[model samples]
Target: MGEMYTTHEEEKLIDIVLDSILSGVVIIDNKDHVIVDVNETAAKMIGLAKEDIIGNVCHKYICPAEIGQCPVFHPWQNIDRSECVLLNYKGESIPILKTVKKIKKDDHLYLIESFIDISKIKETKEELLVKEKAIDSSINAIALADLEGNLTYVNHSFLELWGYGDEKEVLGKPSVEFWQDESKAEEVKNALFFEGSWVGELLARKKDDTDFLVNLSANMASNEFGKPVCMMASFVDITDIKKANLLIKRKLEIEETVASISSMFISPKNIDQTINVALEKICELCGCSRSYIFRFSNDGTRMSNTHEYCPEGVSPQKGNLQDLPVEMFPWWMGKLHNGEAIHIKDVSSLTEEASAEKEILEMQGIRSLIVLPLYTNSELTGYLGLDNVLNTGEWEEEDINILSLASQITGAGLERRNAEDMLMNAKIAAEDANLAKTEFIANMNHELRTPLNSIIGFSDVLSSENFGTLNDTQKKYLSNVVVNGQHLLRIINDLLDLSKIEAGKMELFPEKFVILDAINGIKATMMPLAKKKDIDLKCNINIGNPLIVADALKFKQILYNLVSNAIKFTDQGGSVTIGVNTSNELISVFVEDTGLGIAQNDQGKLFNPFSQVDSSNSREYDGTGLGLALVKNYVEMHGGKVWVESEVGKGSKFTFTIPVENQITRA
Candidate 1:
């Protein structure tokens, strides 16, 4: 290729011209496709020196054409100018704009190739593509508008947010069309134009004209010249968040009111006042004119407004609503009976089926009302209702929930009050019955005791032959009369003592006395009875103290009754023991008997007056059933407790305690 030059100086001149150009140049032999002369720019583009690249095949350095498949040499196709790649010394492909010119100089054909590096232009275009993709995939509704505020571009999220089918539907539309308030939209646009950005919540409308709240951020988009070209905005739907916040606030308020109502019921000052206060709270919270409770009659045939509250300027309806016939409110009462709440948004919306209910409600000046069934133990006893006499206001689910909770609390409180009332009445009736019984026993004491004593004394006199010597049959008959008469007299005395104790008329005469002496006396008196049954009687005085402070007569009576019961229940050849012990400043006395033991089930009734294990007419025991009862009463009067330990077929032990002298004397 150097030989084609006319002179060495001429070749030097051409090299100087090519090296000064910014673009790369290489002259290739058109016949052999081999490089001849290469400029400095082309050498640098291939990362090689001029001497190294001068003899390389043109395809190996700059052109990508394979050997003998030169695109430039083809007759059918022309590659004069094109965007292509240059292969560098490191085998990296560099993008370029290349031009090839076929020229004949000095009768030698050659291809002159020229190219310029375009890496920065390619990079800039790629960056723009990536940014476009990023904006299209964003989650926030993103839109771009022209300077005139007509939409030019919208992302997928924007389509879904505004309920548009596709970009075509919104691309040419004015941005203000999507906003519920056009004036506010204009204000937002003005803010963006003046302030360069605007961020706030605005009401946005969907394609179907349904409005929702959105947090919008708008910014003025500018060109490279720094002139504002369009408005760009991103939107985040905030409708659900707003609603949830409101619901949470509503729930907190309801909870506070419900807690107040529950506290009142827990420790009520008065039921009527509590109900009235609770009604007032419900009415105020519900933003209603009145709140009331309607109760169903026990027979289920009548209803009454038992409790009600009305704010000032409202009429009180409770006085006129008493004893209303249930048949008149068939629909309303049916719902209440089925435990269903009746939430009437507007009384006028009532159909023909509820005409009666509507009439009744409107008569009381109620436009909207919510009546919840009051349940006690799963039975619907009444309804708690709120009336919106001021207007026909809509009721929300939160309101219904509040009313339902209030109804439950009200129902429970009312049920408790009813039970308390019943208990009071029963208590009064029991007191009256006890008084009558005491009076009857008092009358019987005077009427029956004297005759029984006279009968017993006459029989004793006759048996002792005070009048004359009697036959054996006559003597036996007199003995029988004396025994039966004495038993009847004992029963009468026991009855009088029991009545006195039960009526709380009995008094104690506490005195210090030798407890051992009382025990010995009891053993001596009970010995004859024990001997009759062929049973041995014994006394066990195991105590440090021999004295006790108690009612003297009652103490002796307690000992006598226990010892007598031991002797009476002991079988033939069985033994009875009166044991005494002192501990903890108290004396414990136990009367143990080898007797027919009481059944476990019957021991609980032993101390109840007139309660016998075997009370039938033909039972074996002959007790008047008052002796043990009297013992228990007398023991307890001294602030002591009595109990019996017995198993069937295992004998019986009756134990009681009385305070010792040191303890009792201090009292």
Candidate 2:
């Protein structure tokens, strides 16, 4: 009985040890049967109660037909070792990594099977796969390099960044090949070792043989023992940033140059000097080697090189105005006529015909240029040309704008200089004319008064009948003598008045009077002369009684001269019409005549003092030819304009405008 108790105790001890094992365990008897003693974990794994499985056959219970069969059931019947799947009571198969062994004790066969659930292992594998896929899809370049500076792993982003086809092609290659400068590789290696990290810019080469800059961050990765394992690196491209910075620097330089050139205007003296200084500033700032300023003649076909500047020993001759080939510079000609700016970026890139002029420029080392047309009050005055002789590439848009602004400033300076020149010339001409008038007045006084004194003395004697009583024939002759003497005196007075007007010494005495009344008075005074020629004298006053501020006497004289001249030119049976029209701001008067009209060629000479339309016209008119001249001066003094529109045979119309009293009411 003690021996029996020892066996039970030993069996119980073995069961406790088996249940304590972390793996699931099951036992089977001979004939592939079960002496079921499953541990707690084994019972849970098969979904069976311990009592239910205790006496069941292993093949029927754990490896039922139509389910996965367990290899442990027939371990000795087969190879004596096996693994298999087990089925739960619900008939669901559970995959177990199983090992089966046979044991013999006292002629009873026994099977021991051990296994672990592989579902957890499969789950861990799937998690690792997902993490790898996430790393591959990232955009930033991620790479792992060994302590020896050899690449061990590269994600898709890293491969793409360096333009590598696959890991096989790039895994063992040195990371230094990506750096454009070979010396930077040693610097990077030292930084990684000493500081355990490095982050900065690098010039990297591309697959297409191009190079770019990248902002890169690299750090040394180490194991827990402080032993170096690998390195991790991330990079971002910064090529565009570098380029933008360079462009900004260039633009600032151009602005500084524009400011310097504009300062020349403060003391500009001559147009040529102003343009030369501006062009020199542009060439210096832009690194341009050649520049020229060309002045176009009044007829734009001609262009003369007014000023030119080049680097030492490279100057062009001052070209003749007509020698520049027109066909070679169609763009320049068009700009000269149309007042536009021309920008040529690359002369060599143009078509053959367009670039035909490039040979001369290229020989002088010019690659690009800009031509800007200069103007004076809408007239094509000249051109400003700036050329880049030493630059290898085309000029950028910013360069063109800078030079164009300088050209505009130069154009404005030229215009101001031209205006000053014209004003100076006008001043000198006025002084010369004043001196001549003073000498002419002195000569006229001495040459004409002696004859005038005798004529006037005789006329007074004859008119008073102071000499003697005379017969009818003698009296007629004496009347003729008095009439001739009075006409001579009138001629001398007219000459004196004209001289005063020419010297700008005439004074205007202005008064408000109805303009139509003045027109009518002049017509009445000239009617007798018109009647003597048997001509119709008429006054058409379209203007109502609008008052005008003018010298009434001078205004009357202006009208009388025009009307009398009309009557004198009219043949017998012809008509003289004097018309006046007034509006809100202006009064217009027209004197029309049917007469031997003045010739077109002689119209311009009619207003000059002491000048007539023709010698025959003077002979026929029998007076000093200063009437119209004085009439012009009188009209202009009242701020009016006078002009004549006449054809050789179609008669003449003299028109004049006077500002009315209401128009100048404020003044």
Candidate 3:
């Protein structure tokens, strides 16, 4: 060397170099193991003043080693480099990375310790560990692949999702191998590299080669230089989601089908035709080949296939299934009686107890079937069934649910049809009975009227004294005979007229007649009856024209019957008034009386033949209840309507309307 420095100068140079270093530095006396000098950085790192650290034993404040345990004494490892903790003045430990070297100057050896704080590096490593654990525990499957598409890392979730027990099995494998479509996976990878991210659904493959749906979120992973190097992907299993969506779609379809079928039967004009069309719709909805309805007999001992629907080339069983004995299907009927639905995915799978049902189903070539019992009026009336003749598969619950709804609709329709049939039969029977009664009355009319006329003729002759004159008692008896015979004749005449009207043999003999004259004649004829009850009989013809074209005889009869009824119901001294009004090609006639008024509830039955408000055997009024009914029929025969307005204890007003001129064809 060209230059040499003294010991004191060398010491000053070493101190200057140590103070300039960024890391902590300290000098220890090897003989005493005490700190001799410490740099400003060392004093700050140890949380002490330099003067305080310089005289302290190195083991107490700086180094953890005590006595002969110091690594500086080991010859084989004279230079020690390690991660250690430095004790501070407060007895706090500070993590550090340190290097120790032995130095000699002026015949004295020293241990120079160099160290740096490693707190920030340790904190960063802890944060990375937490993130790794989080990724491994995440529910979403996560994986990392290298630029060559080989899996470099996989989390526990990823291995579980792919059905792998260990990460070693997936690592180093091509990422595309785990995907169902390799080409699509590669396309996603290319897009991830080009676009930096990709997100969509993909069909993922399991370890067993089975497929499931997954939602994939893939992104390009970049190195520290910001260059894309690998791909990172996260997947969520969406197989159940897809299945739920399909089930929802199927449910909506079934709901729509049920609504369509329900609408068809709501107001069906022809129930049989509607049932057939409904069966077609149901078959198509359920993807079945046949549907049918079986009706239990009224006695419940037999069943019949009255309605059916079959696709082309499928045989119809309705024709052969008529009037089948109930005992032939014991199991089927038993289940139906319990109101339990029968759903057989495979007919051959039925148990021995259901063998009878199974045999019948097989005979009909049914592979799968469902039957829902039909209940009407709380009684098991029948059952509705759907069959699979060309295809066999388990029926979905939704399909069965929809068909169950359809079964209810069909049962209601059948019940309605049966009720209609019963009503029709009742109506026909009533009409036939009425026709026979009318014929009987028509035949009896001639037979009774001739004899009644002779009795009345002989009574009139005796009352006129054409035969021998009688004494006072005989004369009184003869008067009674004449009055009784006249009443009987009137009753006979009314019965004959009513029979003719009911048989539709009565005709309108139309002619021009004065309405005022007809009213005068009614007034004259009804005055006698009115006087007997001491009732006032008046006619009010309020019209500009009194003449009209109508059936003169029927018109007269209509007025007579109304006036007669008013007189009959009126109490003694009560008034009877016949009022007439005319408007625009029509005339209104009203017969009002001050009498015991009719009840409002009983007004509707006033126009019905033989109907009386007080029909009990014990009653106040005495007369046949046919006058008002006759009035109604005659007015309607002239194309008019009749009505009664009355309030209890008020009075009664009977009104009728007829065209001014007969516009209807004469009968």
**Reference-based lDDT, each prediction:** 0.86, 0.74, 0.84
Count of clashes in candidate 2: 0
lDDT of 3: 0.84
Q: What is the Cα-based TM-score of model 2?
A: 0.49
lDDT tens digits, residues 525-549, model 2? 8878888999999878776666888
Model 3, backbone clash pairs (residues 3+ apart or across chains), number = 0
Instruction: Score residue 504 of candidate 1 by CA lDDT.
Output: 74
User: Which one is best on TM-score?
Assistant: 1
lDDT: worst 10-residue window of model 3: 1-10
Clashing pairs in 3: none
Candidates, ranked, TM-score: 1, 3, 2
Off by over 4 Å in 3: 1-260, 263-274, 304-331, 346-367, 389-393, 461-482, 584-586, 661-667
What TM-score does candidate 1 get on C-alpha atoms?
0.64
Q: Provide TM-scores for the models.
A: 0.64, 0.49, 0.61
For candidate 1, write residues 284-311 as lDDT tens digits.
Answer: 8988888999888888788899999999
- Which wins on TM-score, candidate 2 or candidate 3? 3
